[model samples]
Target: MDLFTSARKEDIARGAPLAARMRPRTLEEFVGQGHILGKGKLLRRA
Candidate 1:
């Protein structure tokens, strides 16, 4: 099978890892409590 299918199968077999569970699915969906990942703050500062 292709990489996408294989990865999905592995994900199903192993379930989501701790780090995977903590990943932000999208930019808007990210749970940003700290100012580090806040809206364009760091990027603007850089």
Candidate 2:
């Protein structure tokens, strides 16, 4: 009925990737980005 509930239903219907669906919902929930997504890290090293 509300935007939040509708969006969640859409996400469920689309069957988004497990990683994407389970991604950190907030910056505080994020983990160990220092290894992959941190500033000037491996992902950005290329």
Candidate 3:
């Protein structure tokens, strides 16, 4: 099935709490864990 659609994103955001909705889209946007999550890190690739 073709998941990860934009419509689904909107639906999820609509149902999510304000804190969850305000969360970052990627690890790069997320603060902390930087010492472990540097460029080409295993977690980033995962």
Candidate 4:
């Protein structure tokens, strides 16, 4: 890839959340906050 392309990609990566960089593509794949965010919870329903 060209230098411009590489720089742009690096910028995108740097700008993203650490969670997004780590790779969980769906809510089912997401982790943490089970006390509030788990299935059938009021927050999840909202």
| Candidate of highest TM-score | 3
- Judged by lDDT relative to the true structure, which candidate is superior, 3 or 4? 4
Candidate 4 ranges with C-alpha deviation above 4 Å: 24-46
Q: In what order do the candidates fall by lDDT, top score first?
A: 4, 3, 2, 1
TM-score (all chains, Cα) for each model: 0.32, 0.36, 0.44, 0.43
Consecutive 10-residue window with the lowest summed lDDT within model 1? 25-34
Tens digits of per-residue lDDT, candidate 4, 1-46, equal 9999999999999999987888976667667868777989867799
The positional error of residue 6 in candidate 2, measured at the CA in angstroms, is: 5.8
What's the best-to-worst order under TM-score?
Answer: 3, 4, 2, 1
Per residue, candidate 3 scores C-alpha lDDT tens digits across 1-46 of 2566877987977999998888888778868787667788878777
Query: RMSD for each model, in Å, please?
Result: 4.5, 5.6, 5.4, 5.3
Candidate 1, superposed: residue stretches over 4 Å from native: 1-14, 33-46
What's the distance in Å from true for residue 5, model 2? 7.0
Off by over 4 Å in 3: 1-16
Candidate no. 2 TM-score: 0.36
Q: Which has the higher TM-score value, candidate number 3 or candidate number 4?
A: 3
Q: Residue 32 in model 2: shift from native, Å?
A: 4.0
Candidate 2 error regions (>4 Å): 2-14, 33-46
Give lDDT: candidate 3, residue 35: 66
